[model samples]
Target: MQLDRLVARTMSRFAKGGLASLRPRQAPAEATAPLAATGPDRPRGSGSWANEWVGTKAAVERAKSLARPGRKRKSGKAAADSIPEGTIRTKPLMSARGVKLHNWISDRLEAEAPTCTLHACVSLGAFLSADTAHEGHDPLAGLVADLLIVDETGQPIAALIRENVADPSRHLLMLDALLDADLPIIDLPAKPTLSMLWGEIAETLPGA
Candidate 1:
């Protein structure tokens, strides 16, 4: 009976601090375990962490998103090469030759097309164009140029080229592209007539 009582007291004392001691001892076992197992026997690189489950899911989704073509911005010669063999970025919106020169003219013209917008303006041109097939978040994302042209004598030319187009959205795109894309001097006309401008602007890529 005495031995039983003594054993009970001893067991109680060990139980009181056993959990604390077990924690430190178990750490070494966890260190040797696979990274995926977050338990005491698992290692740090075992890919086991508090957020490991959600991390794996997010990585998978990110990979899928990146796999889609044209979903991301391409750069350098590779980016320019992405243009199709037959489809040229500077193709004429009206005739087969006169290439649409500015991003604004092309984007606005597209917006006014059938699948695009169908509205027209008195002073400028139509609110949309005929070749437009899709829409975008900013309907007028590309419509005008933002620039001030000059001649040999530094006289500001009144030509309506991209640098001085009237549309606000187009202006912003031109500015952004100029700063970001290192654009070269492009050929444009001064104060292009409304008819000629629309004929040129309908099929341009926005901010291109």
Candidate 2:
């Protein structure tokens, strides 16, 4: 990776500065009142010292600044569409069913980049969406994915995938016998299975 000249210079300056404090400290003022726990000798408003007021005021200012409106945010759909380059999206090459295919893709992505988010489409009631943000499940679970797979029974692909990935979860065997009726599902090699599953992943990855 190449560094820009200005950025490199700034980093060098930081390195030379080490980890010491950079700002000048001001002197503390005398206390306005006695300790609050004390009787009438103490100051009013439950205050121990005037410095407390200064700290409180500074905190209030910071809170106000944070609460103020930032630059109007871009629309959610537009922001999602601006995904960075080199992002991999593909249908699963080896799975018993399409939902399994979706999970297979997610698992591979997690293996490649554990921190990268994975999402799955879900449906509730009569509507379908990638709104797993409100699912109240594991915090580390991937975000709601855009791609959705459904069987003739209308079961959400996300639910099935989540079940397969999470521990102590319900088992979901593929039951959609009709989907492969029109097309021939590719069969994995018998006995020698190592080459069958991983080969698909290798071919999909870059520089494979």
* Cα RMSD for candidates in order: 26.3, 22.2
* Stretches of model 1 off by over 4 angstroms after superposition: 1-92, 95-164, 191-208
Candidate 2 at 79: error in angstroms?
Answer: 3.5
TM-score of model 2 vs. true structure: 0.17
User: Quick one: best lDDT, which candidate?
Assistant: 1
**Model 1, residue 94: C-alpha shift (Å):** 3.2
The TM-score that candidate 1 achieves is: 0.18
lDDT of 1 by residue, 1-208 (tens): 3333334544575578642332232223443442355478644542333243334345545554554466755543333234444454663233322233344444553555323222111111112232332553533344443322223343322223344445666655544444443333233454467566554342232332
Tens-digit lDDT track of model 2 for 1-208: 1123324544465478732322323324452222235576644542323344344345545544543456344553323224444465897543455445556656765676343333344322222322443776433233322233333344422222223345232211111221212211222222224446545444433334
| True lDDT of residue 123, candidate 2 | 21
Model 2: residues >4 Å from true position, as ranges? 1-81, 97-122, 125-208
